[model samples]
Target chain A: MEEILSKLYYMTAFSSFTYQVAIMWFIAFLLLYLGIKKEYEPLLLVPIAFGVLLANFPGGEMGVVAAENIALEGGRYKNLFEIAHDHGIMNFLYYGLIKTGFLPPVIFMGVGALTDFGPMLRNLKLAMFGAAAQIGIFAVLLAAVLLGFTLKEAASLGIIGGADGPTAIYTTIKLAPHLLGPIAIAAYSYMALVPVIIPLVANLLMTKKEFEINMRQMDKEFPAKHTIKNIKAVKIIFPIVLGSVTAIFVPSSVPLLGMLLFGNLVKEIGVNTLRLSSAASGGIMNAATIFLGLTVGATMTSEVFLSPKTLGIIVGGFIAFAISIAGGIVAVKIYNLFAKKKINPLVGATGLSAVPMASRVANEMALKYDSTNHILQYCMASNISGVIGSAVAAGVLISFLS
Target chain B: MELFNEAVSIMIVGMLTVFFILFLIVGIGNLIIKLSNKYLPEEVVPVKATISSEPSNNTYAAIKAAIDIATKGKAQVTNITKL
Candidate 1:
């Protein structure tokens, strides 16, 4: 009886089953803290954290994954911490959504549903700003290649510069699934930090005169009697055309491009707002974000993040950011020359919308220059264009790399 | 020393790779547009405002419109809630 009892205890001790669940539970709490206390990208991050918590709970898909680490590299990196490259909740999320390119575009669809593209259409030059913002993507890609990342890995890392979450996640999964864990975490974290990051960079790049200079608001009257009859047709055309082009030129990017276009297709179809919004904003998008974030965060288990490779991603991302900003500024200068009226250079900053955060930052900076000066909405117009631009650049990069 | 050497190597090779790709894209994008104009169906007529009335774009327009609506003599008239 004593011997049997001892064996049972041993089996349970070796399992680490309860402990792994505890660890995931702790992670969930941390995500909640980040959401409630820190208020860091709460809408997306909170759900993500909870997903991590659930995934890690014993018998919750990730339990078996954590158990494997103890068997395999569990003892190899004794002194050093090890991030589970495979197995567990992170593994499931990665395989299901990130690898499949399922979630980000759906999230983007929701984003599209909520978005007003009016500003982007009005200022044709904001299209240039959107293009300009993509400089970071190339800059980072090159930097990654330089750091001895292969073409695919370089492409994956460089996409962080686009600062669009779904595109980065999708591209990385295609180009370098191994690096997805770090890249996704980095991409979303930087997006959350954009208000802090871009402001610092923007201020460093421009002077008070450049920032303060207010351009007169353009008279942007919505075209009267806009017909929806053909709007759906034109909308459908964008996805089909872009999707076909992407598949033909760069098949690797087809997943990202397809998902995005599908979202737009749903929007264009416009018959079922309920299903469209559900596909875009509801359970599917939310569940994926939750899964994407925690699983990504869980993947960051010490060893992976501490490497020289991570350093490469970090530095490469900033290189991308600076170059993208420079591209915007350069475009603005050239646009100013030919234009009859001088537009505010600050509008150039909205080329990357961490949603309204970057746009608002540009607006506030402008407000400081002239209290009555209001160009916040104009900056936002460019910001949305930047989101589209980032997605396109990612698609283009994936095409080239693949 | 090794890091510096690596950096120089990366810069040169990376710069070339970037331009090569960018050139191809710019070339292709323009080519497609030109080719389309030369070959494909006509009439995807975009908006017809030659000059942007204000230097700013839709962001400004939306804000200005909202403000105008907000500050109107009878601001209550533009009660958007009905929509």
Candidate 2:
């Protein structure tokens, strides 16, 4: 009877409970609440939070072991079969898909399929603000390095400023895979908070007059001399041309950018490549996101995540977010100083890779100032360019650090 | 100090490269638009003629009556022409 009781207690995980495990559980539950109750990036957060729960189940042995831990334990690297047999399925998925740095680019392909470059293509000048926003990445990199993180780790942490999850995850996977858990969480959390953050910074920097700067009125006053006659032809040609140019300059960015352009190409081809485009944006992308969220979340085991560095990352990420938004706004304000046709500072604020959310927030803010000022299209011009800009920035960081 | 220097260099190079690439895109994008406009301008779909003959007095009166009813006597049909 005594032996049986001991075995039952051991099997139930009650005997293995620790304060760290309990703390991880609390964090996981908080994320779950945020995901479900508040609808904060529910699709990703739900899976990730659930993954956290699974990883912290004490005796479950489901958490992903870091490569260094595995090497240190066994005095050598283990094969996939051995890893699966020893550590379970979570480790298998992590090492196989997430650690191999395969899923982020696949997700990027889907993003490209869903994206339309029409807005950016129409207002090409606004694309410069997208580049300006990338200043946050380097700024945070410097800060993180000063705070004692290695260059690679700092780069991973800094990329949270890009406001892109896949870009952050991809860079972290390449540079400092160990920091993947915290970096991804920070990136996605800040992205989900785009609505709150954009207004917070825009309100701080932009005046009522700047908010009321109507893009449509400006366009009527100074109409573009050259209008795209065959927009369809240009749309089809754009991905091809931009892909070649970007690849020529930043060859390291090919995996993420190349896949994105390929997906866009398939989408632009219309009915002919409809199947490929749908597959990329639908099933393939969904599956990749699930694996990515789960595997990445599983990496946030109690021992790995309960560090001073995680706190630093959380703080640094917010600074990065604020700085990126400010960089774009300041750039536009500087442009407004000289340019005859002034752009809404709100349009510049949307120059982060949070997609339609950033643009929508800017548009809503614009409408608040002037009912007739609908700047969604103009904001999209900068917002879409931001996606490309962040990816390029990620590539540069990868090339420099890794 | 070396790390700081490397970080600064990265900042300069990364920003410049991003700006340069996007600038090139803007230039090429304009070129593409110009070429397409010159060669493959949007095909103007010709509108088919709906009315080939003049309307009779009775037909014009009927149309005027319909408009007057729809507008509740607020509008008047001043002129009538046929294509």
Candidate 3:
């Protein structure tokens, strides 16, 4: 009977599963439910939730080993190569993609392929709103510090405000690798909630008059015809100039912004590189995102994710997102005080880097207030600029804290 | 207290850096657009010309003929070139 019991015990996951592991399994199920049923960031969340489940299962140790006993071979820092060599497939994905800091920039390259800077170029002033929205990142940083997180942890937590998932992940990995799971989850969750959160903030802040303010450039009656120059020269020159300037100013951002501009250059350089553009944006990008989501989720083992700090991260993330929207709206209001033509304050709200979602929500709110006011084009200017602004903010944090 | 002070400084510097860089891009992007618009504006393409060996059988000629009739000879097809 004892021999039979021993054999059964060896076969069962319960024999090794702790209560904390059980709780983690439940949390993973919750993430899966949110991803599949609620349809919140399903592309990322589904893989992440599955990874969490796998990580918690019996004896595989399907997670990156935490930073421990490391005799530095060079420069007093642990060698990533040594750390990566010690683990399984999940660790390979984690260290190879996340630790080496390769995946975020790769994803940014794909984003560049899909993005158009025409709207932002047309409304140059709207880009300021994108910059203003970054205030939430810093605001949350202060809040996190007040709450007792280290400066690096606070910075990582604060970046969730930018609403840019790749930047959040990249910054967190660099500054505080241990906080990567919660920070990534917070960033992506709030990003997926853009349609909900933006409107809530916009409605609370902007009056009907502000929403009714029709953006001039979008007005058909305005004869200036603020369309993007279809010249291939402009397309070729813009990315090169932007990339060069970004690299010169913020070398830290070069990895993310450089790849972004490179991908855009490849697309714009013409039909000769069309295949390359398609592959970068399609196949390679998808692969990186899958691995990124899964490994990040797997890192959220019970011991790492269930701490008191996790709650602080969640609350801090929400504050960051909310305050960023408020900052944008406030900036627009201040701009209106000085400008001849007033922009819709809701456009400022879309300054968060959630892209079309934040901009679309702004448009929806505009339409609600005045059926004729179409500010999506104007809103997109701020939306795309927010991407750049967030990258710059990440660079600043990396430069200062790291 | 030191952490608080550091966080404040980070907030100030980070926001300023982001704004400065983006503002520079905006200024440069706008300047480029304005310069391109001024120096190398898009050509004012009134109508595309159609070229065909058999002008009467071509779609352009048929459209031209329809336009001529509709306008009562007020308009004429000066050139027809294939797209």
Candidate 4:
């Protein structure tokens, strides 16, 4: 009886694996708690946490769960979390979605469709605001280089400052795939926390006097004819012209810019609105978001995420974002010098990669400063400017380095 | 002392070089955006409800003839024919 009991103990399976699985579950629960309770970027994070829960289980699957090396008879597994050595469903998910660089462009097309170019057109000054927001990219690059990260690694690390999650992922996947896990997580986490993160940084910028101004009226709806004609030119030529420059100069950036532009072009010409809108709002975006969150979570598998280097990346990303804000503020002040009318400094805060959130927060902050002041439109101008500025910066970096 | 001077000179030159480079990049970006907006912008706009044509030789005289004597200069009137 004693010998038989010993054999039974020896045969017990997955004890070690079980412990790892439990830790992963706790982390997933933590993500869920923060997403729900904190109300921090809930729309994206809720789905992301659910994806993580599905991913962290033994042989974590994409949407389905099963025991054994089993499928429906001859079908293959698609789960993202399998034993480390075994290429579980997770492996196939990473291979088909991430390794191929497929999700971002499709998402970009949606961004194009949903994006309104009217604000950017009405407030051309916003372009300067966009340019100012990119200060963090170079500042972080310099810091990374000084810290002894190799040049390629430094550049990859520096891109976190852009604050745009897709842009960061696109750049890093091309430049340093090995660092993708930490980089992507850090980028997305900050993006998801934009509402919390930006307001604190923005509050310091304007005095009590500045915060009281109301800029809601400045959110002028552009004249319909101007929008109908002007928007197409910007939407159509923007990707093509920028893509060519980025590709020809920084060939390394071609994959990212090319696909991003193609997606935008689909929306600009307004052909196949169904397919384009679906890419943005339907299966592709949802599936990609789920995959992006899960695969990134898979990377957090204790062995990889628990490191001094990962911590460094996170800290560096925050600094980069703050620096971007300072840059935009400074740009606004400089523009004020040459132009007759002045813009609120709060608008400068929107230059960070958080896009419209920075603009909204800035505009709201202005309303706090004064009831009569209208600066949202002006802030939006800068917000759009930052987008172009970062893309241009990416093109510049790739051109010089590649 | 000699080494210190060389270090100072190198530091100054390095700082200047970085400053100039940053200025050039940002300056060029600003210039491109400004020039594009200036050179490529929306066309001129014309106001509605203001007539260019005149029934009389002088627009002022035509206005005087069209308006009521009591309301002259307060609410100028245009000729019905012009409408």
List DockQ, one per candidate, in order: 0.04, 0.48, 0.47, 0.03
Q: What share of the true interface contacts does candidate 4 keep?
A: 0.00
Q: What is the C-alpha lDDT of each candidate?
A: 0.61, 0.90, 0.86, 0.60
Instruction: Please give the C-alpha DockQ score of model 3.
Output: 0.47
Each model's TM-score? 0.66, 0.91, 0.89, 0.69
Residue-level lDDT of model 1, residues A1-402, one tens digit each, is 999988887655345456545655675687678777888888666655665555554444442233234344535421112333435435555445555667666666666655654454334444556666676776666566656788778777877877777787777766776676557656766777776776677777776766765655333322312222233334445455655664664455455545656666676666765587556766767666666665555554433444678777766766776666666766676777787566667677667647777788778878887987787777876677676567666666565555
Worst 10 residues of 2 chain A by lDDT: A68-77
Q: Is candidate 1 or candidate 4 better by DockQ?
A: 1
lDDT comparing candidate 1 with the true structure: 0.61
Model 4 CA lDDT for position A141: 71
> Which rank order by TM-score, best down to worst?
2, 3, 4, 1
Count: clashes, candidate 1: 8
Query: Mind giving the per-residue lDDT tens digits that candidate 4 earns over A251-346?
Result: 554555566556566667676565765566566666677776666455455444456777778888888888888777776667757754455667
Q: Answer with 3 or 4, whichever has the higher TM-score.
A: 3
Model 2 lDDT per residue over A1-402, tens place: 999998898889888899999999999999999899988888788888888899999878889897874464547677788889988999989988988889999999999999998998899889889888888998999998889988899889889999999999999999999888888888988999999999999999988889889999999999998888878888888899889988999998899999999999899999999999999999999999999998888999999999999999999999998999999999999999999999999888888889989999999999998999999999999898888889999999999888
Better of 2 and 3 by TM-score: 2
Candidate 4's residue-wise lDDT over B13-67, tens digit each? 4223323333443444344444445555544466687655645467667557657
* Model 2 error, position A220 (Å): 0.4
- Screening candidate 1 with a backbone cut-off below 3 angstroms (N, C-alpha, C), the clashing residue pairs are A48-A290, A65-A88, A136-A320, A218-B54, A219-B54, A377-B59, A378-B59, A378-B60
- The candidate scoring highest on TM-score is 2
Q: Which whole-number lDDT from 0 to 100 does residue B48 have in model 3?
A: 57
> Which of 1 and 2 is the better model by TM-score?
2
